[model samples]
Target: MTETARTRYFLLAILLIALAAAWPELSQPGLLNTRGGGDSPFLLQRLQQLETAVLDGHFPVRWMPDANYGYGYPFYNFYAPLSIYITFLFRLIGFSFVRSIHLSHLLGYFVAGWGMFLLARRWFAHGGAGNGWAGLLAAAAYTVAPFHLVNVYVRGDSLAEFWAMAFYPLVILAADGLFGGGRRGVALFGLAYAGLILSHNISALIFSPFLLLYLLLRMRFLTKKQENYPQACTEQSRSISQITQIGFFKSYKNLRNLCNLRIANPIFGFLLALALAAWFFVPALAEQSLAQLDAVTSGYFYYSNHFLGTADQPLIQSTFFVDYGVVDREAFRMGLVQTAVSAAGL
Candidate 1:
């Protein structure tokens, strides 16, 4: 197929998947009325507060007046803001709160699918191992993945995490491009990384190690020495000082001779992201003790209590039925067909 034809087909597929995923909310507006269950109701309440705060021209809205029974709390100071801002934009454009939330979910699926397609296509191109069809299938797999569905439909619909997940593929793709001599690659990577950071701090933290690994792998290729260093080293055993000198000179030589822009691209991107997100993170780190962070770490909602296999019921039972309570151990699950497809893909 022509490139345009392929693009059209891919878009159509994404639209179909998004529509299918959002059908429940679209068909029955009442379903959206409930926001989500459990802490989601609390999230919706916070979003309402955030919306009012933004609309009232509260710059860098840190304090939530409605929280803690009007005594106020620094909810926005630490919470990620990108998804909230997007939903606020939707509200500004005349969408109701419920509709805006649902639309965000739909958009998340679309963006994530597109990002996955771009990453897969770029990786395939670099490896010279597959074609566009591989990328398309990969995108499809990601868009309808069971965990993604569960997140959207079952698990309090944590829109912030969904937004972060949506940006993950884009960040990786931008990083790859930065290393591969693409135009404005550093800027693109910075924007994508910033988006990931703003969307969900926890997801950004989870992705950091993988991002570092990718940079290291790319650096290996970008800084490969052309000289026969092994032969030079084998010529004679050297003292510790001499070995240090050789290593320093080799590193300097690699930096000097590095023709590719890849080595500096990710570093620039990392610095730029830190700069962009400093406003939020700075207070978050400094004022952490003031918030009830301990409540989050250890309480009824403690992280330790939420692991898999901690549920009293069988995994199979919990996987199929939606939990009515707030603290179900496994709130997300893979559908039978999705599990089969995942296994096949594996």
Candidate 2:
């Protein structure tokens, strides 16, 4: 197939996976059951609060009017703003808040699939995975990932996290492309990393170390010397010893080029990314003491009590934590299909 045709095919397949993953939201005809369950209700309320605050000329929206039973709180000061802002854009264009939420979910899934496809294809090209089908499989695996679906349909639909996940591959791809030689590479990496931070601060924090490790490995790949030694010296006029010495001399001379890893790419990219995301995180960290971190971390929501895979319970049953609350509990499993795929991989 032509290059354009191949691109189209990849995109079409990705689009189908995105649509399939978001089918539940697309199929519901009536208004969203905001009260159905999970954190969706809280997120919807936050969306409306954001709209109100924005309309009131609150650019950063630190204080929310209706938080804590009508006494306002600095909701936007700490919360990541990208997802709600995106859904609010649809609201500005005349879509209802409910409809906007649905649309955002669709858009999030599609973006996730697209990002994964691009990253997977690049990885395949670099000989990390098989080409063509590998990209599609990666995208599909991520889009319909078990915990992701459970988060969307069960855990109050953490739209921020969904959007954050969508941007992960894009950030990695941009960082990887930094070594491929282009003036725009660092700028693009900066933007992608900024998007990740703005989408979900926690996700950005969790993924940062992994990103740094990957970049270090990539730099190593660039600096590692090639090992194509002369098997049979053909030119007898130039003795084998002479040929070997010449080859060694040339390799030694070009050592600088081989080790030409742009160590500044990540530093510059990270500085730019920090500058871009400063609008949110600056006030977030600075003014965090005003907010009661104890309230957020204490009680049933204690950070230590809810770590995944940390519990000794069986994976299937351990999915359900905090069984004491009156709220309906949903146990999320990482699907049998994914397990089978993992087994096949092993």
Candidate 3:
């Protein structure tokens, strides 16, 4: 067999191994239900409040304290109602809130995986490295990522992260289109971005800066292309020269080109997005924006830990890059490196 076949088979083997490792976690009921009964119960309680308010025609803007929790609502300043609306829809259809949330995660995972595959395909095509294998690798890598696995385990605010991860590929497509890649990519991008914003406000906030930076990079690439136009012009260079000779006018034209991306290819897809978004956006926004808000004392927990001498407790922090466990330093170090290497597909 050829080297490519060998590599493909190897990747397939690795994928199967990973999936096998994940089976125990996935097979168990509520495997993603990390909040367990305590947090899950609280989450359901919030959804119940949201359901009542929506049915009553006034979903509160800020969250109200759950009678059971007694403490004020912890999620005041940060609020996004996509998950709540999803739960409410299920409740309307006779499903329990917990079941509805679980179903949403299960379904959302499919969308995320498919979207990632398509996005990776498009990206590889654009990069002149058209490999379906690469796309598959990326899609699988993202879907079974540690962050995603952890989210499944915790199964609370992490739902937002899952939604964000799922839509990320589309965002890249849209940004690419905005820079003159293609109308379809741009349109898919806009619809994806809007859906992401509506699903998780915090994720949108975090993603916006990266989107803007990509635009900036594309603009720079255009400038470099113009500068490389030859002194003795070919047809392409003549066009470039004519355009670049206009100086500020050329700059303005480039900016306008980047900004005015009217996507026509994905009209149907975007329309579906619009329909889904309409179901929840306004009500969710109203509830989130108007809810009684509070400012948590940032770092208070950290400071309080110091005061109690528990600050010295070993930390187990896991996210994109940082993974540390204080319980066993040697094990932690070995695990971190191994996990990082595996994640990088080494």
Residue clash pairs of candidate 2: 38-156, 39-156, 40-156
Can you rank all candidates by lDDT, best first? Answer: 2, 1, 3
Off by over 4 Å in 1: 31-39, 126-130, 221-262, 299-327, 333-340
**Number of backbone-clashing residue pairs for each candidate, in the order shown:** 0, 3, 4
lDDT of 3 by residue, 178-226 (tens): 4333434435665777778766766776777887677667657756675
What's every prediction's RMSD, in angstroms? 7.6, 9.9, 9.5
TM-score to native of every candidate shown: 0.79, 0.81, 0.59
* Candidate with the greatest TM-score versus the true structure: 2
lDDT of 1 at 196: 94
lDDT of 1 by residue, 1-346 (tens): 6777877887788778777777776676643432233334555676688887877889778878778878887878988888878877778889877777777778888899888988887777764434566777788778876557666666654778888989989998888766543336767888899999988887898798999998888767656743222322222112123644767436534533332434444665687788888888889999888877886657765544544544453333333334423344344544355555568877
Of the two candidates 1 and 2, the one with more favorable lDDT, higher being better, is 2
Which of the two, 2 or 3, has more lDDT?
2
Q: What is each predicted model's overall lDDT from 0 to 1?
A: 0.69, 0.73, 0.54
**What does the lDDT come to for candidate 1?**
0.69
lDDT of 1 at 80: 86
TM-score ranking, best first: 2, 1, 3
Highest lDDT: give the candidate number: 2
